[model samples]
Target chain A: MQLNESDLSWRSLPGTLPVRHAVVSREQLLLLCRDVAGRGARLVSLWGEDRRAAGVGYVLVVVLDLTSRLLLTESISRSPNPGFPDLSQLFPSAGRMQRATHDLLGFNFLGADARPWLRHSAWAKDAYPLRHDFVAAAVSAPPLPTEIYPFVRVEGDGAHEIAVGPVHAGTIEPGHFRFSVVGEKVLRLEQQLGYTHKGIEKRFEGLSVQQGSKLAARVSGDSAVAYAWAYAMAVESLTDTQVPARALALRALLLERERLANHLGDLGGIGNDAGLSFGLAQFSRLKEDLLRVNATVWGARYLFDEILPGGVATDLAPTALPILLDSLAAMAAEVAVLQDIYDNHAGLQDRFHGAGVLSAKLARQLGVVGLAARASGQAQDWRAALEIPPYDGFAIGSVLAEGGDVAARVAVRFDEIAESLQVCRGLLTDLPSGEISVAVGKTRADELAVGGIEGWRGPILVGLRVAADGRIARCHPHDPSWLNWPALEHAIIDNIVPDFPLINKSFNLSYSGQDL
Target chain B: MWKILKQIVRTGLVTEPAPNAEPRLLEHALHADIHRLFGRALCIRQVDAGSCNGCELEIHALSNAYYNLEGLGIKFVASPRHADALLVTGPVSKHMADALRRTYEATPEPKLVIAVGDCAACGGVFGEDSYAGLGRIANVIPVDVTVPGCPPTPTALLQGILAALQSPTSRVDKRSASTYQKTEDRG
Candidate 1:
């Protein structure tokens, strides 16, 4: 509690989770951010909420992850002048979050990059979508011609810019990337996302806490289980509802299965991007088999809507347990074989060996997480660090690689899939017996709760505030892609254009997650 | 290469045989006409309007060894200009509305558009009146067929594409003109 002694008058918030909150003037906010960073706490997410309906004007929340606990800092700027001193100068990752805050809520982060990040000419300049007074029904006109964004220029010999996709050649989400390259080498990479921004944050307003879980699941599809669990954790904490041990174990199972499925797919994708079609065919087949088991056991290929607040929507069937165990065993064996092939393949080795290197220095600076962070030798796995419920008993091993190359990322995925398989098997072997779900009581008004889960990608943080009538006032689901995406821009520098796909696939940051 | 060959030999053609084409009664009736038009191969161009990437994962699964969509003479083309059909997913976001229209117009004439997933079919949970989403693919572009689910499975997506190809002229009679009207009005 380094922030406890500050003259800022910190207030302890009432919630089940361990968090501290303080309302400071805009000037104190800068000093607080600097102090927190100096004490080795990383800024997890920064978002603005329009509280004018509550007569509190606009509130900006900054969430920091201090390894063992979370520190939440808030400051209110009145409607007449909604501006705050920018903390991006202290934490580089805060720049985009501040810019996004400006775009969606009209909260100006002074001295930060004021360029719009999420506002893509879909609305008029003064019409902020997240504001309480902003009407969602008034935007009926077709999208206007998007103004040509002035991308940072790199004027030098042979440094022409190449712009790619809001739509891509492959079956993926829409995101535009601007590459400033000198002949074959990339000088800089700029990503303009939010093509998939569906006003999800605003859509969460006024929904019942139970219904909000469904919206949270869709925030990023691949990590649905994690997001749902995180949302459930937040709601349960706010309401002080105790989730059954069986439900907690089941959630751990689903989260690990998600990790395995995504890693399997990415391993194949990395191989395919490196020109090994065999890996694509083989790994995809394995992933499909895994999904089939998911269909049989969990009743959906993607495991959508399975995790509900208080507990799970469905329990693992008695008849399906052995079948699931068998499949996990088979998939583990197959993956081991694939790992050997990937390691020995000359072509894949040549392509993956030294490409898209993100130094440990750069990774720490950008605060990259998940497999990307692990690949760069940063062991920031929440399963190990946070020790929440099932993960604590499992003793989940930390996977790390130093090179941060495409190969290192691929290796990390392989290690993680194997680790998750073991964890899943352990959870099944000692299946806890109890009620799968319990009734969650009413959430207290004005109570703020934070939920963090180590999704396959990394740690996903969900910050929730309950309205006066026990409905959701505001929910911000922060994906780890926020920190990891900038790392992609750095990883691409000095790499060739053709290698971009390979590097990007290795990182595999989510556009849907980032955009939302 | 030998190691790969050895592994392949051990695996021994793991691909499943294509499922029997038990077209729905309506699809069966139009299947003959579609067969006469496109013959064997179908070139598809997928457009992601504003999905959570759930549908895209299932759609990509269609190309795996088990499903083997390419084995069925169905290929996903890189360019819309070379496509016979557009497989769309997600609710049409405002930012992507124009791009979705342009992709539709870029495809050759007599093109089929199949909306996959609940989001594309009817905006799913986000709904039509949200500030960012337009609700359904049909609201933005002409949808010949729609396969609805939170994210429809790969088999369902395949069926939706096949059904759209079979009944190419079925949905064009009424909504074709209005699609342009909506686009023009919005623009």
Candidate 2:
């Protein structure tokens, strides 16, 4: 990979770019990231603004490495309107990221796939919401603006398109999916999301760093702990602040509990969808029991508003220690019973075995990550890979399965639950005695940092840029769903429409999370 | 038949509790009316206008063992016609306005509307967003109960449903409400 110390007239920070400088041209910047990406670097964040700096408008793109955790910045003048060479050709998943950049900012990624990732008719054709000139309080955009969106269609005698949701029968998130199907089998499934898009990124523009963290937590309620912790990590890194040992442990504990709760509920629900009510009953009970223990130990059942900037809101009580141990013991036993049932049940096995098979090759090609990826034999888990503090203290074993099917996903969850329970038990036994939180002092302005955590779903990454007055300049909480959502469409290809719920449940991609 | 019998035998005599499972004693306590309404069967139909899916997750979680609504007479019906109450979880999207109204209309009389989550209650964070206009369920339909939470836990949803069934201290005269104050529907 090539490295350059190209000069940028814009602001520069110590840890931002490797060389304490930025590339002047967008081409050089793109090439630098391209080189690093070619050498197997996962670009974490790409963001910029149309700033009137030095009497000129400029857009910057910052990319980071998944391995080194280093940041690189690229800037170009707005006059030439330079576009980054489409990294989508190099990384298929980059298509969405590049498309998002194109949509929000006016910057383009040349020769990228044509489909707009999030341009879901929410705005007019010419309107760019992320632009500096774009008014925040604009009530309406011009109506009936037509734009082309490409979806590969299958032509046959009796084939038709089935448009589902944006509004669905079941209580779920809104996302429009147009399915070209013949009979029960789906030929192609194209998704149109951003129906619940609340302009969270735009709203984060002027909030204080601490308040921005609260907003990050709400990006997706299910992964609130992950998002909050990520934001905290970013800010802490910016301030070069090291959180206390006890606070780190508490955060880790909460994170594990969050993962466990979500997994149990999802595992059970997937089973229920497959007509295995026994799994549903048992797993759901375990999940509920776990959440109750959480509410008693922590404040909330879903554990909302517990995680704050520097550390947690409240400390785990000395009285609650033994209770947590007992709850963990109960969870272990109950999970064992459910696993036994899942293992031996012929009907459940039949339904789960080969259904929704996502091959390992396809998973890699599609850049699928998280448990869904792990189930399909992609053994990368960010918590273990990144060697974050509490996780560093523990032996984090990566779970994998060769089957790449619904059964494999179930097996992965079962393994993860066991591991999480074990981790929780370990935490309880080795529970630290100290203050749960420390007061996070006022954040310095122009501070930018990146935070990442291995959430139950996958890596929850957040990038925070604080303005001069300690308000947020930009805050982007990237959910694992951004990488995993497309995998669902591919996984459902040959599967019948009747089993769509099962497949969808298995992945459980968050629409709000992705939209943010 | 044999399989069902064998399964029942294996599971050991599955039936509704003789003295009620003490609904409030479950980890997250249920409302008193819900405790009384336990095993008093009624079908529930859920409507989604535009939610973040948090409320839906809790609703799905309700079927699990700890606060199993099935143990009480509460059931999630597949069809609106079969339902006695409508459990709406969303901010009432402009696109879904028609479908939500139609579903409510399809439900039988003495129907209850239990708006689940902060989104359904007051649109929560998504309240002021462009797409999610008229944030609460009460804005669209006459809501009988509101369970305020970023997605209230399953127990809270149960409580809300129970609260809906209970007789209110002050009731609006229906004749006057239908004609004059139709615009002002209190949830």
Candidate 3:
């Protein structure tokens, strides 16, 4: 309420998600963050862009997830090593985001934690890949010598550090986990990610806005539909393109399917981590059945390119309905039985019950979003909260948990699977008949727009700026992992080292999304 | 226990037949040949070389009831030293370039590497030798087989592993490669 329309000139950004953007001064920026924090606004994402090309200077953008809408504040810096008052004191995740912004673009945030994130042996100290003037060829320059990460040491007797990988034992993404442990008891867990940073942000630059959708889908392979939808929404808004109601409904269908697919897979992985191979076996089979159906109905099994810029690439075939409906019913029956098995199983419950307890108090303080946030009693589901477009047509409600433990996260996942299934069925049954897409007219230059869609992980926000010639001037896709990853470090505190995987899976924050 | 057993019984063997082994004569003999010639489990160490986890999804699916990779005497081991083959995914990122090399070196001799997905094959859309290394796993290490897809399906992955197993030598025959020559260790 401190940032009222009367007090601040908030320009509404056109998109599905409720967003109001404004450029403020340095002192006002800090005051605004403090005000929002008091009003229970969760910090969604913070990113910096080099607008020096457009002669606007270095811009640091912070997105705040207010109860019903998103408030974006931009503070500009004129000179080198530009410093802005850090909001990490109010929101803990801001520290890492600030560090990442500094790592990519040379904007500094005045914070206690100034550690370099997403910068490995890939570049030199002075190299800023996201800067407008960064040469593309220089990215392939000779690898720099390794710099030892200054992980905070636990200065106590019997405390030792155990370092896990950027390259782990399994077929999982790369990230380094440093565990400060005493025997099997974990004192603290600090993660240094960026092994997956293949310059996804840098690759986004100079690409025609039309081609950006394909790249966005690959941002995090799992959330392909979400990223694509969010990107498309931004583009559509910027171009003043109004998609047909049917296309919006289809987009919702695809988004829900994407959620169902991820929840199914992650639920299985969670069980697998907790020593339930039976769960992994059964759930994964269910997932495969789902993917195979996707293959038959849609051309791709993973549905990587199913969602395009203007609308969905392919419309639902007549045969897809009965098949999809039957599959959902069968999967629902099997999942319900599996849920019972998991519920009654003594050992599985024992492992999940109290491990990695991220209290509701801490959860809100850290500004965690998505399913992870909901598990800890933060009853903020973006779909239900905003009710944007197709979602507005239906009554979607938040599925919440108060336990803030591994078990709570699992329960939320189980409930979400059922909810997503119901949502998908509703969308399919109430099919809207119309054109699937419309031609997005000429790209408008110098327009800054934001798009947000509730992906399976969380609400993904993309702050897009078009260059003078209609190319992507600066596009920053902020993943929910930005807020949740730091929460993971806190969640593992005082827990045993062996339980880390199960706890980590409960949150399952994206390394690629956060790194990019 | 009875409920669990009932569920297991109801969902009986869902594993499909493995992908194409070779010509008519080699069809039924592929599984038997592994036992007859190698006479051990084909252990694989999967390294995600900066993938979006799309390829990893399929790789993980290989272990599902439908694929049941373990039933075929193939296991995804934790350590590279214990692995007979390395299944790598993604266009190798520069940050992960050294780790990939170290992993390649750590695996004992007579190792087979199968690059999964299009990114690892020719770098896919990211382009070769750009921001993210050579964009192909073969550029960093010796690749015995390559499976192409945005993310090759689990069945395709099973076939790639089997294909790598059937190759006469551990390394790919560079002369046979038509698209691009001079793999780091192409014979």
Candidate 4:
């Protein structure tokens, strides 16, 4: 917690969690960002809120992860032309976040790239959806043709361009990719996402704090538990509700299960993309088994809508723990066998080794987070690093690989799956006995809280602010993909065009999460 | 390779039997005629309009050893041109509406459209009020059958696809199917 002289005035906000807020002038924004980055703080999220009704023109909130604590700095720009100095020059990952803020709120980040990141020509240039004056009904009108987006061009002797889809051949989410290639080698790769934007952030504006959890869960379906828990933590922190210890353990259990399920699926996907169908079949089977246990015990396969604002919606039945333990034991044994196969196969090795390599230097430069960061030698795991709640008591090992290639990503996933299984078994065996939920009364008005959880992908952070009437003034659910997507762009550099799918699947950044 | 072979031998025939081909009463009443019109095999092309990827996960499970959708003469195709039906999930995002329409147009005639998941059926939590989503799949393209769940299970999704394929009409006109009416009533 170091604040430089440029930080105009700072105050520590009272909440369940410790959060320090600072008000900086527009002139000090860039220098403050540089100072913070120089002190080893990583930019977690950046967004703008329309506080015009409060006579404050607009506010830019910058969230940073300081390992031991979370720092949220807010700068009110009361200028007729409300904007702040850009931090993208200091943190390259801030480029997209700043661009998105500009697109949705009409606030300028001076000196940052001004290209539309999430807008995608859906509305008129002057119409910023997140503004207080903007009407949702206007979106029903037909949008203009968004055929020609300006992608950076490469002019060279043998340079050729390849365009993939917003509508892909697979049953995956939609996103377009443009590759600048010389023969098979990719010179540059640019992604155009936002095909899945559903006005999620704007929809959260008028809802009660309790109703906001439902919206958060859908921010990214794969990370539903993470988002829901983080949202609950933010609301509970605002309301000053201490969740039951049993509830915390249950949340950790669900989070670990989510991690295991996703890792199984991704391991299969990575192997399948590398031309190993056997791995796909085996891992998909294992993932399905895990999901079935979730459905039988938790009442939903994907575990959607299971976590609520106050606490979780369901509890493990008295008779169900033994069954769950048995299933976990069986799955662990099978995964052990699969791991041996993955490590032994030489053909798989040929496709994975040295393909789509992301160096440790590039990963840190882009501020990459999550499993992808760990694969590239950045050992920043929220569970281990933050030491929050149940994880603080549990022995969660940080898995890292130095290769930073497809093999490294796969290895990380494998290691994480094993570690998560141990965590889950520990949680189940030492299950505390108590109520799974607490009544969360009205939240404190005019309060803001930050909640960060170690989601399957990485750290899922939610910055929540309550209005005077206890309504949600702003809720920004920042996904780890925001930090990792740019890393994907860097990872594919110099890799052949055909290996793009394998590398992309290796990272597997969520389009819906980032698009929102 | 020998180890893999030994493991396979040890775990011999772990795959379950193919799902029952006997169509249910509703499926038989609606799609019995079409079953004979097209061959037994059905080619499905899945389009994710704007789902949270929950439905997509279950849809992928249909290919695993337990569900074994391919063993039942059903398979997911890569191109809409070769598809007999379009299995769509998610609330139709404004950006994806045109792509969904184009995919529908590309699918050969007598194509079935099955909207899978609560989002696809009636927009789920992100309802019609959303600016970026049109709410339901039918808002953008004609959906023949609607499967409702935050994310429908693989069994329900398979049944929806099967029912759509069995329905006599290749492509049902928008809002014409009894299944659509049923889905609306439930929602």
Q: For each of the candidates, what fraction of the native contacts does it recover?
A: 0.70, 0.32, 0.69, 0.68
Candidate with best DockQ: 1
Return the top candidate by TM-score.
3
Candidate 3 or 1, higher lDDT: 1
- Candidate 3, residue A64: Cα displacement in angstroms equals 1.2
lDDT for residue A371 in candidate 1, whole number 0-100: 84
Question: Comparing candidate 1 with candidate 3, which one achieves the higher TM-score?
Answer: 3
**Every candidate's CA RMSD:** 4.1, 5.4, 3.8, 4.8
> Which stretches in model 3 have alpha-carbon errors above 4 Å?
A1-6, A135-137, B21-28, B132-134, B168-187
Ranking by DockQ: 1, 3, 4, 2
lDDT of 4 by residue, A1-516 (tens): 444734456565544344567766666666777777887778889999888888777999888777666677778877756778888887899999988898888888877788888877567667889888887666677655775678999989999999998888787889999999999999999998889988889889989877899889999999999999888888987877888888889999999999999999999999999998888988888898899899889878877667777678898998889988998899899999988999999999999999989899888888889998889998888877767777888888578999999999999998998899899899999999999898998888766688878898999988898998888999999999999998888889999998998999999889899998
Q: On residues A1-516, what C-alpha lDDT tens digit does candidate 3 reach at each position? A: 255433678988765667888989878888788887887888888888888767888888878888788888888888877888888899888888888887888777764577888887777668788886777767567567668999988978988999999888777899999999999999888899988887777777888888788888888888988888888888987888888888898888888888888888888899989998888888888888989998998887887776666777899888889998999999999999999999999989999999999999999888888998899998887787877888887766568899999999999999999888998889899999988988888777877787888899888888788877878877888788988998899999989988999999999888888776
Error of 3 at B61 (Å): 1.0
The Cα error of candidate 2 at residue A408, in Å, is 1.5
Interface RMSD of 2: 3.9
Where's the lowest-lDDT run of ten residues in candidate 1 chain A? Answer: A1-10
Indicate the residue-level lDDT of A138 in model 2: 47
TM-score, structure 4 vs. true: 0.94
- List runs of model 4 lying over 4 Å from the truth: A1-18, B14-35, B168-187
- Shift of residue B122 alpha carbon in model 2, Å: 2.8
